[model samples]
Target chain A: MISSLKIVEAAENSGIDQNIILKFILNEWVVPLNKKELTLDEEDIERIKLIRELGEEFGVNDEAIPIILHLIDQLNHLHLSFKNNYCH
Target chain B: MKNPYKILGVKETASLDEIKKAYRTLAKKHHPDLNPSNKTNEAKFKEISHAYDQIGTNEARTKFDQGEPGEENSKQQWSSFYNTQQNAGRYANSYADQFGDDEFFENLFHGAHQKRRAQNQDINYLMDLTLEEAVLGVEKVITLANGKNLKVKIPPGITSGTKLRFAGHGLTENSGPPGNAYIMINVLPKAGYIVQGHDIETELPISFMEALLGAEIEVPTLYGSVNLQIPPNVSTGSKLRIKGKGIITNTDVGSQIVKIKVVLPKKSDPELLKAIKSWNGKYDYNPRGEK
Candidate 1:
């Protein structure tokens, strides 16, 4: 479980607002975490990090991020098509 | 792991407003979007994003104040990181040395940079593959039109129009970072086996005798040979779907489809011809009419 403080830390680390983090959670952008004391999971954290990077790299508005995030989630659920390292 | 304040080059006691101002300033400065073909500056941009992300918020600031590890935030920072290598070779540009390596790191250590990556252009290319190579997962030495040889590992289960990204391997890395080389998979049609999605389609010719009497025929697949059971009284054209016997998916599941054709002999034996003629001048049989 990712501690609440760490969630805040993650926000600070990415230089994004807490609202953005909360928005990710509200939109189900990241993986579902154990609902214990409002803690996010490791996978969720990684996804959030990637989202932040995309926003930074693409100059994408945080509001527009959900589209890509949704697309990625859809693709992941459908199944990975890219064959790279660690792919069987 | 350093202090977020120091990373973004902001003061520890800086107000939230000041922190935000500092963040935007640094983001606009060292940002991969703004930096021109400099990996070092790109790295610094990451650091700036990392720092701002850590200390820019109240919760994160409080956590940093209390000495708690903001692992999620670190990961979040990474998300914002660009593979400058794939961003049109910006990371590979020789101009990064304008500020010198030491000066670049010093500025990052000081939290002064901007977002320049998104402005840097990216490149993409289409790649072609053979059915045999795609099925067997061959090692492809692809030579681009511009005369660059790239060794690519062709994975099994790849479909036509699939795209692959090779980091730092495009035509040019103009400014921010080297862009990725995109390999758009074009699987050429095979001679006998027709590919459709994850399933393989094939047509096999069976003699009328074999179709009427029912027979087991050997059909060639990518993996090898499999015996197909032809049902008795099978029609001229029939399609059979084989479950889990087709091409491999990226996840390694198999699927297949088979089409069969019943062929008749061009010439018949005298006895057989006589027998057919006796039945032919015409038997009142219309399988398609009012049946």
Candidate 2:
């Protein structure tokens, strides 16, 4: 299926700082495909759109969202490795 | 949005048997008749019906199961939760903020912080899910009282108590950076599966003879049941591991752990008794090992 653009457009529509948009990509919460190409996938567009919306709706004032996200990543990796080593 | 697996409360990866099973179970509980007090349940019943309609057919479940969420005009959005209580007045939902009379939001997000804000504050929405749904992932549409609709894209590999966000669709206008809706999903536990640190542990009862002589027993996992080999002379409480048969997380994968509970016969026949008596006299076996 073609990638959607709703996500990126949400950011554009909201006029949010482009930095948050860049941060989302850096964090891998959102992925970009074919950087060489000008076209954005539907998923990329839509996800950005939603991220833009989530910010406005909740007013999540914490700049720590990225930190929390990193924590989530660390916790998941740790949990997986722990399970790998554990028996029964 | 029309994933039938969502209606039957099954996953895209669910087998036909699994889907049927889920449908029966949900139908029994959420069928408007069984549930009366909850209008939410009634609405859920409709949703299930709609989902089933899309998935019950072999042709449809196949399409939806393989397709990514949000096709055909469904939009998704999320605004990362920022730490700014003082600024809440500026970004609060205009409709919701109407009740509070907060002048802060009226002008701030609408006018003042235009250059700085990327999106609005993420909205918080609570979604109640079953353990199965949490493990397998599901698609749902959260409809607000105001008729605004959000068809959620629940990605595969989420766990119980996992939170998902939909960006910039909550009470904010489509004009400014729309805020995200944070869906804090609570998974209702089910019978049989035991969730531990990334492992789904369960006790599979095996016959004494099987445990003593080693046998192949079926064990359940998130993927399904696989025949597990129990070594002969295996004692009760022995654990069997199926590599890569554990939990699947959003960020990574885990394994399943099965504990074998050896079951003994409560009563024995006369021949068995005689044989046991002779064996007991000869071997003098004690389970506690003369502690």
Candidate 3:
């Protein structure tokens, strides 16, 4: 688990604004595992990295983030289902 | 305006579940987060979203099928409603009053950045690895486009298409922080080995005498060569499994499967041929089961 300060550091290292990460959390784009301490896991880090990529690389705006995130989640679910059914 | 059913890649008479499934599949494929944004994918995403909005629910589908004015008008009217609902808590004034025009509102919702900050561009680096390196892991020193060298530690058991990210290793901005670097792993194919999940499959060639006499021979694995006992009369294309000799992951260990291939000698001695002729007359064995 990583703290919010560590997330901020990671955001800074990745050229993302700390405030933007906080705003994403506030907007429910990236929810922390522990709401009070704001602890994050590896999955949350990956999600934040993706969010940063979408925003900085793809120029996706805040309004479309939720939609894109939901689509990505659905895609992952579909991929997992297929893998479970066929590959396993 | 495109047809909703065509945009979602479903028939007009498709059920609600079919429509939803199609929409989810297409939306996942063309989602901007997963893919790099281009004109075609962006347009396709918009079309899909619009189609879903038009016919996502049973009521909406029925109205759309009926070609009613109420549904069409309601679709156009929802833009302002969405803007107002999305921006209600953030903005003091209504979106219409603040933006003053549809063009600006659309830009604000889609592309316009509220607070402009100088950000370095993220870099994607392609890294190729051999099958052995991928299974055992390796350390690689890569030189970036900017002439800087970075040493990367690749974890063991990494599959192809895995990505490793290095924070703050990309281009540096004058005002803001540096960007990140991503290493995309590509595993090259190896001869005589097929990777299936964590397990590995390889063909083990054996002489016809060895196959008939059940000889213990050394077979190659990822770790090293190990001795395997072949049963007598082992046929070609027989599979032999060596447990715990495959690619190792965090949770489970895999097996190495060896496919047996029986090889006959190119030239047969006259004495051996004569012996075989005598043996054939003695057994009267018909492998084909011909009467």
Candidate 4:
């Protein structure tokens, strides 16, 4: 499946504002493939959705978003490392 | 839908300032954004916001006092709480300090995208190894979180709880260097061998006849099986040392200590019983010190 999406497609697919997606990209929370072309993968779309929830639903500010995203990413990495290394 | 005054820990006759103070304190304490991993805190935050909405404004307080249900402005509660966080100066100035508040969007989109270096996060993992594998070096393939396979070589004579660090093998960042990965080793004990420091202790079971008469027998070592000589009339619990047969590390070489155990037949044979009975009176010996 073609999972790579352009910035406009990502905003339409995720129902997030284009400006907000740009902010997320600038924050480096959701890294796209080409900064100039703004090509995002599926994981980037998921991160954009999470960022939206953190803002609109949880009332998180822009300053706190990066910190929360970093912590969540660290937790996910640790869990994945454990799962992959166990019983092999 | 509990009592608003009770939930906010204020009286029905509380002033606006008092109500606002209580609501801000409770909302900040239970904010879901701050405590992201806590579901209880999120639920409590919602409840606190609901309570604040019930009697937050003077008109709402009056309506509540006049026996009317205070309108539940859920969206308004979030805005107020968010504003409260901003006004309280918790993380207000940090955003402005990082990127100028007025020109943040302009600086972000325009040619002002300056690259900044941030510290990468380090990660730790647990690894299991056999006693032999720890004594003798082995190579392992570990799959990282990024689905990359990393080959790690564990040095010989590594004990349990030894941490091996792999540089730049942790989480990767867009602007910063990747973090390091630590693999902690837990060495599982072998069935027949017990490792003591640099030495290995193993038990060898010998026949009763071998114990009575001198015999050369083969014993297992870390390197391979070797001949071990049992002296005549050897007793149980006797220890024989085999030099340089245990662990071999870079700095040190260890020996293997073999403990002897004499095994008697479970069922008694008639011929053996007869021979023992004939030799019993001639021996006239009591192993115990009792007369």
Candidate 5:
């Protein structure tokens, strides 16, 4: 029952340009669920927002973005696993 | 709410370039993404960013110098930015075009800006539903942050984690169409039924006598009760499928799966004990095939 948004909808919702979202996909910063359809989930939208915040607000350059995204993904994965282990 | 110039450690007369340099220097040191393990850096980074946003451009600096503070200052900055973007042909269907003759701009300067908020982000509301409410459709009224009551019709057989989108019902923005509201459904755990996709699974407790001899037992369903025939020699964990009695969704109608649980008599009967003792190993059966 996970809801998905098309690429255009994702761009509109995240307030990022479609071209930037395309660039994010090209750079593999955000992976779409369906490559052909360019369908994105809520996670992808949040990632796009994070990328925009990092680039626009924090002035982080393009090169450093992927590194930060990877680190964030790792942290999220660890946090989820930790929650599963302790909370349940 | 501290002085923007003082927060960035720049003089009031500092140029935009000098302010930008100061912001970059402080931002690099305090950026939360760069210093993810540090908590205070996040707040410091926000302070720096806020200071920069307050006085980053000439227009914003001018507004700041005029002693306009808080959200009013930011709204004017955004309004001015929108005007600039509109004049540059960036926003084709921008806010200016939408409210061209509505006196919105006049209202902006007249301090009536609180009537509208610039929201371009979709809001997610977590909706909790009981198993019965989910299986059977129900209409619910939810109060949003704007104090607007939205009546949402819960569709039948809606599963957990399903998102119901309300288009154009989100926060009204200053420019483009309002964002959407997504209702995320989370079904609470029910006592008797376990939801598996569209199907419902529940245990039917029957006496050992009923298991030994065939009997018609009444089983509870989401909609109503159904009489199920328990065949002779039914074992524990055996599932009986009642077709089209589970959940009815738009796509499909599911079946209710009844798991058999045979319960023994709490008190032993003298006649039964004597009969069992008389036939101890003579009619013994190995259920596990251990023999």
Candidate 6:
């Protein structure tokens, strides 16, 4: 787990705005490991990075972010299901 | 309403299996989640989803084929049909939760920012990675289009189609903040290795003598070379699995599968020919089992 400060630093290194990161956290787009302590895991960091990408790179609005993420989650689930069926 | 078959890119005479395959393919292609911020693709996705809902199953297809109603009366008929078949609850829930919201469509189509401020355009940056680099994450400095150098960290076990985003590194406008930069990872194919999921398959060429007489040979892996033991009398195309030598991901580790290919000497020596003739005379071996 990483602290919120570390997330901010990583975001800054990636040229993302600190405010945007905070907003994502508040919006539950980037869920923290601990709400009080505000910690994040690698998965959370990756998700935040994806959300940042969608907003900055794809110009996706805040309202559309959740919908898009949900769809992606579903797609990933489908892929995993397919892989599980054939791999083992 | 558009024809269900046409929307899914299938013929009316297509079988249920064909329709299902078509729906899955089209859904993956135009899924709003995969192609975010693209209204046209989102609309297409919605259309496909609706068409699938109309004729996905046998009963649904039968009803649709019977000509339930035209475009004018489809709205009421679809609602009633959806209400009657509770089994379609899965699709209904997803559609209603995601695309059925009026606010979502408004935001997607005609949000306040649509007319007021132009969002920054996204920048796509392509990055090539070797198999080793992909297996083990690497950090490198990348120069953006705006002449700014930024250090990027690539995660381990990244495969093709993995997109990493660098926030606020995209085009900037006077109206709002800068856009994001996406790093699309393309893992170059290795000559000897073929990656299947987390596992790696490679061909190991061995001499015929080595196959007949067991030998330990060095096999190449993602990290380095390791010695692998070959059993005596092993046939060509035999697979040897080396545990925990394939891909390393956050959750699981894969193995390396080495396929053995027995190769004979290019030129035949006189001594070898004479020895082979004597051996053949001593013992008649019918490899083909025809006798």
Best by TM-score: 6
Per-prediction DockQ: 0.05, 0.04, 0.04, 0.02, 0.03, 0.04
**Between candidates 1 and 5, which one is better according to lDDT?**
5
User: Native contact fraction of candidate 3?
Assistant: 0.00
Tens digits of per-residue lDDT, candidate 1, B145-185, equal 45889888665555677667666675454566666677888
Worst 10 residues of 1 chain B by lDDT: B84-93
Question: How does the DockQ of candidate 3 come out?
Answer: 0.04
Output the number of the DockQ-best candidate. 1
Please write out the lDDT profile of model 4 over residues B1-29, one tens digit for every residue.
24789889999888899999999999998
Return the TM-scores of chain A for each candidate in numbered order: 0.58, 0.43, 0.78, 0.89, 0.89, 0.74
Return the TM-score for candidate 6, rounded to 2 decimals: 0.47
True contacts kept of each: 0.05, 0.05, 0.00, 0.00, 0.00, 0.00
Tens-digit per-residue lDDT, B1-291, candidate 3: 246888788988888999999999999998767766332355457658878988999888888888763445444433322232232212212223433344553564588665767778879999999998887667899998778999987655667887677778888856667788989999999999999987999998899888989999999887789999999988899999998777754334578999999998899889989999999999978858965
Quantify all predictions' global Cα lDDT against the true fold. 0.61, 0.56, 0.69, 0.69, 0.71, 0.69
Which pairs in model 5 have colliding backbones?
none
TM-score for each prediction?
0.44, 0.46, 0.46, 0.44, 0.45, 0.47
Docking class of 1: incorrect
Cα lDDT, model 6, residue B2: 43
Interface RMSD for all numbered candidates: 17.0, 17.8, 19.5, 22.2, 20.4, 18.2
Worst 10 residues of 6 chain A by lDDT: A77-86
- The best-first sequence of candidates by lDDT reads 5, 4, 6, 3, 1, 2
Query: How accurate locally is residue A70 in candidate 2, as Cα lDDT from 0 to 100?
Result: 43
